[model samples]
Target chain A: MSTASSTVLRGRVWKFGDWVSGDDGIVRFSELRNFADDHDPAELARHCFAGLVPNFAERVTPGDIVVAGRGFGIPSHPPAPMALRAAGIAAAVVESTDTAFIRRSLNAGLPVVTCPGITDAANEGDVLEVDLAAGRVTVNGTVFAVKPFAPAMLEVVDSGGLVPYLARYLAGNARA
Target chain B: MRQTVAQKIIARAAGTETVEVGDYVTVTPDYTVMQDIYFYKNIKILEKLGVHEIAYPDKVIAVLDHTPQAAHGSIYVDRNRESREFARRTGFDNFFDVGRAGLRHLIMVEQGFARPGLLVFSDEPNISSIGAVGALNVPISTEVIVSMVRDSNWVRVPASVRFELVGSLPPGVWVRDLVQAICHDYGGGDGLIQRCVEFGGPALSTLSLDSRQGLLAGMYHAGADTALADVDDVALAYVQERADGRPYEVFTADADAEYDEVRTWDLSALEPFVTAPPKHADVVPVSDVSGRRITQATIGSCASNRLDDLRAAAEVLRDHPVAPGVTMYITPGSPAVYSQAAREGLIELFTERGATVLSPGCTTCWGYLGALGDGDVTISTNQEHYPGRAGSRKADIYLSSPYVVAASAVAGEITDPRPLLAREGKPHVHS
Candidate 1:
């Protein structure tokens, strides 16, 4: 199977600590009411990392990478992830994860690389080169291995997301 | 690759021979229900994706149980209007409005939408409640809500974590106790992360059908993808009573089916347990924290709102009035459950004992319908206890079983329920 070696990427890193739970870490449950009626994705993106770093939105540049400690997205809500995608987050790098969190991330069209020690791989504002096909990351002149996406998963992601994948699928099926 | 029960169900739904762990499959759901919170959000997403029509309206069930009907706020009023409007627009057939159903998961089974060997989906993540009926229930993410609106959703097959039950519970020990023990043993829930946790072995025969639902409740936030039990006589009868002649399939794991790992639990040795504040995994023995003062007590959720749970609470409140300065709320899981309890005089008994018996709905647990003031301490029958989950981060919430909740409400403090059970000459039990 084709692995991370063929999938190369570059982005500046925005870092955080361990156990950034899906609930408060991504966004507070109380704040969900703000976006409950009609949500603006960019507005949500502005509140990114508000629970940890209040000034995070001001610092976040498009196409930046998010590196965080173990068990990122543990509460398993999707708003923060949706915010990341809307904010043009290139990918997510976390130490480890429960598979449900992985599913949640991918379903939201946010690529996540589960490489242990990812937290120590780079500091905030450092540009890191990630090779998804090779399961490797180069940060500050040092390189390390990260888990790669499966061929099937890469296909879904490359197609943009599950919605787009299904659009192509239903279209082709209708043609057939 | 070896298949788990969850994989088997998903493969069957997709019309495939087999699927391994991490293999993605798209299956049309047998049923899909959304809580009131997601009702408008799903419609909005579907519209954003340029889908003007729902593909399977009959397959969708609309549940308006969260955020009380006639609640005194704009959030509640707007959501209730959107819920009705969505059902009207999509022509969804299985709409469970406030008076009809109390919890989305219970209504799916009681109304016979989820049965043996079916694939069920809901937008609500706490859907471990649906797994009790010998079916696979996936509480999907928002992205899949688009797929569901378009008639399909992708799912990765989950590996199985088998939990074998042995022996029977002693007096005053309950199924919630066993669930708490599993959480504690797994280091507050790491062993079964993202895996299907299957309950089997001889001890199941000793439990009632509703108790099986309790077994799935604790597994939700602990990160078990799904919790299941084989279709025993109890499960079979429960389904038969509610299935209404709908076609259903019953399945068990193949003899050669592989598990990630299997652990056996002796329920006989288990004791009543109460979870500490702010997290489900911070559990302690009830005796360890006896007499801690409580300001509020709430019983009845998808976890423990059946007739059996009501009877247990009634038994506790029998001849014992609720403690002054401690407010208690008892909400049934469904109109059927509340109607049955009312027919049996349980509602009057609760009211007579100074317990505020609310009809079927979710309140005080989800933090929307009713909220506690700051510095308040509450003991509830809810499983999830993230900070601010109950409307106030300043308040402390302790998760316990319904029996313990009732006893504690009466005492105005967290007290072990064994003494109450012994006085009634009954053993510790669950629905």
Candidate 2:
């Protein structure tokens, strides 16, 4: 297992369909109800995709990617992406997703790329390579272009999420 | 370059002349709004970042809207208390305590914090409701903690999709129906994904600020990043009355502004619509599934629950009792809305008809109050009907207008409100 700060990632794909809700699909709203102030990633990870794919938490290995169809992660609940990261998912390649989902995913230390046809191009258990910097995905000898994250946002993902990025930012400002 | 309304607003906030789509710029929001549900979580994140002070205390606003009365239990009670202490510690005068609380989206506009051409960052997408007054609210989810600490955050300019609303809505065809129809048409695929939606054209003159807010708030169902309405006298008048000497700017789209897509919708052509359970965009006309029995009904949420919505519900519940075995909950959006509904006799009519009048907050819409039992079918004016949103996953929640919710409660089934409206004479459209 490797951190997401690496520019390129190789993972087995886990496929999902369109409109998989962040609340109900990725992580159930019920799982989020009882957290004591701070949401423990390990606890949330145990329930990640438990609603959609039973035993997903146990089966998913670190650096495995999530590929989905359009409108993935609707109603972008903040903890859904965090739960995915905690459950060892490295990156998400989707046909489309809302802006909030993109921001939340990056802030949770998970990188998401929007590729127009990634869902149909890849299958479950297929080994895929994602080039985060180049905004390209390769599967089965086929390549697809994806919308790349902006440099500033990429820096946040590279620093292992927004909290760490802001820590460094505030420290840099103080030093200056 | 001809810029869209959103571009102009962002440009002003970013201190730039203009911004093109896909351009990332750091901008200071006019207001950074927080709700109780995520307030403590944000503070925890801020502590992790080692930021002790809020960068812009004057621009920060916190509201105890989601669990104002701590409807759930002790956790919410504790969170609410801590939120108050944090606000006081930070010297934030904009905190709306329990009694003054409402849905943050509505309170921001009602209190004049969300004004034309100002940018707001919030935790939920429905905060786009501020667009009704020509303000843009970007939903940053948990990242609002970043904005609170820095007073600014980076935003990627999104392409705009323009919906030119034409013609007036027919009687009994509420703004919710029109919004659902638009969602049904444009929600599929990537038509509106991550895009800014702007509403304009001939019908803008007739739609009230409440209607416009209702319409904009539902754009999230269509996958819009955020939404805005063209500024007009109707919007300006409402803002001027509430702004209370606060300065604001009004931005309009250039005549030749570029849009990713231009769509025209005739409001009169819309019928009473319903977004069925499990999907916000799975919209169908009310007649398609009219006779399904309903055990619970509610008329509240950030999407609806304004004065006009309450009045609409009252018109349907007038002289009628909720059917046996049916429980209906009515939540006004804010204290002001509650007081006005009381003055207008809407609350009295609702209570006399056997419906529960909850405090002015998120209420059942948030799955906090009036949680449904297993196998309970519900008709509600709230947005989002994902499984288990209102308690039981076995329960089926249907989303519609206040009129439909009231009528369905009265009949104990999914019933159209047009017949009831006809029986009661012409329906009143409150602004």
Candidate 3:
């Protein structure tokens, strides 16, 4: 992993009002799919953002991060996270996530970070300079109190998720 | 100092010293799984850092079960695009997309991803129930999971909050409502975080896996790390199928596990509970809130959208028209639940009785579906009733159990479920 002491992740901050329980809301940016259309909640969820504007995917700079208040995805739609992963954002830090979101994100090798009180600081378009070791965020040179990421979580963030982290480990094992 | 189940389990998993209350243990993660949405975003971060290859991709399962599809807005559209791009760029071989998949817990158990005897860390609450199948699994701190993927160990900390569930739950009352009630009764605060929650008493046996999942959601919402239920054959068999080469490990609290706080209640005395406004789970008795002229009533969501809950609601609404002027909406949890409800004619009963049935999903529960105009009052069986759950920020919401919600529909206001019990030929008891 590239060892940069600090990097300023710049992007618009999107806040999720609910929790990430299952696969719901993963495709909030798709063609405006409604759960009632197919009479299958899961099916309609896959068609999310079928016609919505400013899909989450299109709102990112390379280093942008997503933010949320609590309970991001409680509906448990499996493909919800995939849409976000597909969009190529840098990282996600939530006030809380459902276990489904955590499991699916990790299994899919996604990086999800959580701290109890992250919503207190950091606005939607504020440029953030994150110091990994110190676990603090700097906005306009002012450091705000952010929960320090767990070592494993930081690894996931550094490796971009579980798959890449595992791939590297597996390859190293083979090489050794 | 006594040890709780959480302490004992973490102690055994670490295989070192026996731990007492107030102790902590850092452990190696036996298994780690990621929800695909964040995984994709994390992948992009990794790519930027010029890092390739994961530490243990095989041990790690990449799940793409979140963000089912993007919505009509450009922002959501971009979210999906980024997710898809992350999946493609990461080269995840085990990605399970929409349509051909089940839930995270079901798919992991079905695909043999989680096993018994290992300490597993997950990001979700009910998803942690997959460990309930068998194993000394405990949902870890999210920040910890994100940070310590490389570390194989953690400090085994003891918990002070002890929540005891008693008696048996009535039909139609899922664990989510109970959880909300618990949070409502006892404020959900930092005090419960990192605590060990042991759910037991006869009430647990009556809970189905769906109910168990809901209860676990409560524990997670309370911010506790581990929740253990008594194991049975069904759990054993489920674990055996996915255990690969791992031996089964059971973590039970020694008769002497310490509990900083303990509270118990009889579920039999638990009536159709309801939380009035401002919050989904901040509960008030149905009797207290009845006659509030509920403009809307809805059923179906992760918290209350189970078959049993629907069956219970249908029995109440079968031939009765939703009290005049009350707009009723029913959205089944999933296709499977919908088909079962339909087979039983529950869907037909609700629709025939003037209740508008939205297809199975999070309709109206989220701000996206079953919308109401400003100043509308709604009664729903959902996890939370925080502002914006259904639309207008000025809307007044009353959250209740399915039975209570159905009863409220017939009463045209929030009414006690006790009258319904008598109407349905059952005895009435209140806690």
Error of 2 at B381 (Å): 0.5
Off by over 4 Å in 1: A1-9, A15-18, A34-43, A85-88, A95-100, A113-176, B48-50, B187-189, B426-431
TM-score of chain B of 2: 0.97
Residues B292-362 of candidate 1: C-alpha lDDT, one tens digit per residue: 99999988777778777788788788878999989888888888888899899999999998888776766
* DockQ values, each candidate: 0.33, 0.63, 0.07
Candidate no. 2 TM-score: 0.96
After TM-score superposition, the amount by which residue B274's alpha carbon in candidate 2 deviates from its true location, in angstroms, is 1.4
Count residue pairs with overlapping backbones in model 1: 10
Better of 1 and 3 by lDDT: 1
Per-residue CA lDDT of candidate 3, range B201-253, in tens? 66666666555544654454445555666555556665666677766566556
Q: What total of clashing residue pairs does each candidate reach?
A: 10, 0, 169
lDDT of 2 by residue, B100-207 (tens): 888888899989898999999887788899999999988887777776777778888889999999988888889999889878877776798878899999998798
Clashing residue pairs found in predicted model 1? A3-A133, A4-A132, A4-A133, A4-A134, A5-A133, A5-A134, A6-A133, A22-A75, B172-B428, B211-B431
- Note the Cα lDDT for every prediction shown: 0.74, 0.85, 0.56
Q: Candidate 2 — which pairs collide?
A: none
